[model samples]
Target: MINVVIADDQTLVRAGFRSILDGEEDISVVAEAADGAEAVERAASERPDVVLMDIRMPGVDGLEATRRIAADPRLGDVRVVILTTFDLDEYVYSALRAGASGFLVKDTEPMELIHAVRVAARGDSLLAPAVTRRLIAEFVDRIKEPPPAPRLNSLTEREREVLAGVAAGLSNEELAERLVVSIATAKTHVSRVLTKLGARDRAQLVVIAYESGTVRPGWLS
Candidate 1:
């Protein structure tokens, strides 16, 4: 079963999420928290497979809580899906940088939210094409981009291609078709790229692909 923790300051939101998730046979709502600090604590204690974290919360806030959880070796199996009412670029960028595996607008459809948790649990990012375009637009000022990660140098040419495809929000199947290779080859390239770049998942790979100049706003579809 996919264990989940819902963290939001609003009581109604927590109840709503729990209600939706509890109906799924393969998923379980293991815990709920009203604040970021509590969310972090619950995550550490419950060790849920996925955390639906609110971007804005009292005390530490979701960004910091995500950072703490992501940084903890003990919680390495945990994946955080940032839940927020705002679709601001800053929030999207910050959440990913803070180690969020995915981001969802608070009003996301119930099924989408459920699917997001499953995607994150499988170590895949929930990136949509529109989301990728907006993300790249927000960081187009490449001059002020983050410092280059040395690990980026470790990627082979094919891996770099895979990284760019990932930043473009292509799934493994799409990537395979684009490269004219088998899906297994595409998956292998993605795995190698993640390892070489030291990225936790495709979300971080997207970040590095942009920051390293492998992908750009103008190039996005």
Candidate 2:
């Protein structure tokens, strides 16, 4: 089963998510927290596979909670997915940097929400291509000079292309089409890039791509 923890300050919000997620046979809402501190505590104790976290909470807030969870070696398997009212919420990038696997809008369709939980449970990021490009580009624009990514030097030319494609928000299938290779080959390339970068998932890879200047804002556009 895919264990999940719903963390939102509002009671109704948590209940709503629990209701939607509990309906899934493969998913279980193991715990619920009304604030970030409680969320972190629950994460440390429950060790849920996925955390549906709200950005704005009474105390430690989702970003800090995600950072705490990401920093904890014991919770390495835990993935935090931020819940926000807006897709482009200013704090979303910060949350991602703090090790959140992804973000979901509060009004996301029930089916999409379920799918996101499943994706996170499978250790994949829930970054839709168009939204990811726009979001990452917006944040990258503010960085006058991104720090160099020395680790990128270890990647092969093809691996670099795969990284760029990932930062551009291309799925494996799309990447295969773009590179004129089989989908399995595209997956292999992405896996190699991830291994080299030591990224936890594609979401962190996107952050590394932007922060390291491997893929710049508007370059894909």
Candidate 3:
């Protein structure tokens, strides 16, 4: 089963998510928290596969909680997905940087919520193309000179392309179509890139691509 912890300040929000997720045979709502601190505590104890975290909480807040969870070696397998009222929330990017696998809008469809949990459990991100474009537009300018990535030279030409596609938030199938390769081949390339870079998942790949200057703001256009 894909165990999950729902961390939102609203009781009804938690109940709604729990109801939708628990309805799935493959998923289980293991725990719920009304704030970030409790969320982190529950995560550490339950070690769920995913945490549906809210960005704004009373105390530690989702951003800090996410950072704490990400930093904890014991919780390495835990993936945090931020919940926000707006898709373009200012803190979403920061949450991603804090090691969240992705973000879901509060009003996301029930099916989408289920999909997001499944995706994160399998160590993938939920960076939709439109959301990615908006995220880039909103924060690209804030990225000053990217830090050096000495390991970037380790990538082959094709791997470089894969990394760029990931930075642009392309799914494996989409990437395969763009590269004119089979989906399996695209998956292999992405796996190779992740392995070479020691990235946890596609989310980290996005961060690495941007920070390494392999992909720039307008490159997706």
Candidate 4:
């Protein structure tokens, strides 16, 4: 089962999420918290497979809580999915950088919310294909220039190419077609790239791709 902890300051929101998730046989609502500090405590104690964290909260805030949970090696398997009412790019980027596996708009459909949790639990990034380009564009708009390149000495040329495609929001299937390889091979390449780069997940790979200039905004469109 995919164990989860719901962390939101609003009582209604937590209840609503619990109601939606409890209906799923494969998922369980292991705990709930009303604030960021409580969320962090619950994470340390319950160590749920996934954390549904609200970005805005009283005291500590979800961002900080996510950072704390992510930084702790003991909670390495615990993934966080940021919940926000707003789709601000800054929040999205910050959450991802802070090690959130994914995020969802608060009004996301019940099924999508469930899917996101499952995706996080499965160790895949929650960034949907349709939003990937938009996310990269927003990152570009926010930064005047690319940051310094990350140390990519360990990557093979094919791995670098695969990394670029991932930054472009290409799914494993799409990447397979683009590289004329089987989907499993593409996925393996992606996995290898992530391992070499020390990325927490695909979202961080996207961030590194942009920051390291492996993929640039102008390269799109």
For candidate 3, what is the lDDT? 0.89
TM-score of each model, paired residue for residue: 0.94, 0.93, 0.90, 0.92
Query: Which residue segments of model 1 deviate by more than 4 Å?
Result: 140-149
lDDT of 2 by residue, 107-126 (tens): 98999999999988988888
Where is the poorest 10-residue window by lDDT in model 4? 127-136
User: For candidate 4, lDDT tens digit of each residue in 12-113?
Assistant: 999999999999999999999998899989999998999999988988999999999988989988999989886755776788888888788899999999
Task: Give each model's whole-structure lDDT.
Answer: 0.86, 0.90, 0.89, 0.86
How far is 59's C-alpha from truth in model 4 (Å)?
0.8
Instruction: Give the alpha carbon lDDT tens digit for every residue of 138-197 in model 1.
Output: 765545665666777888887888998998889999999999999999999998887777
Model 4 spans with C-alpha error above 4 angstroms:
218-221
Candidate 3, residue 168: CA error in Å?
Answer: 2.1
> What is the alpha-carbon lDDT for the whole of candidate 1?
0.86
Question: Worst lDDT window (10 residues) for model 1?
Answer: 136-145
Q: Name the candidate that leads on lDDT.
A: 2
How many clashes in each structure? Answer: 0, 0, 0, 0
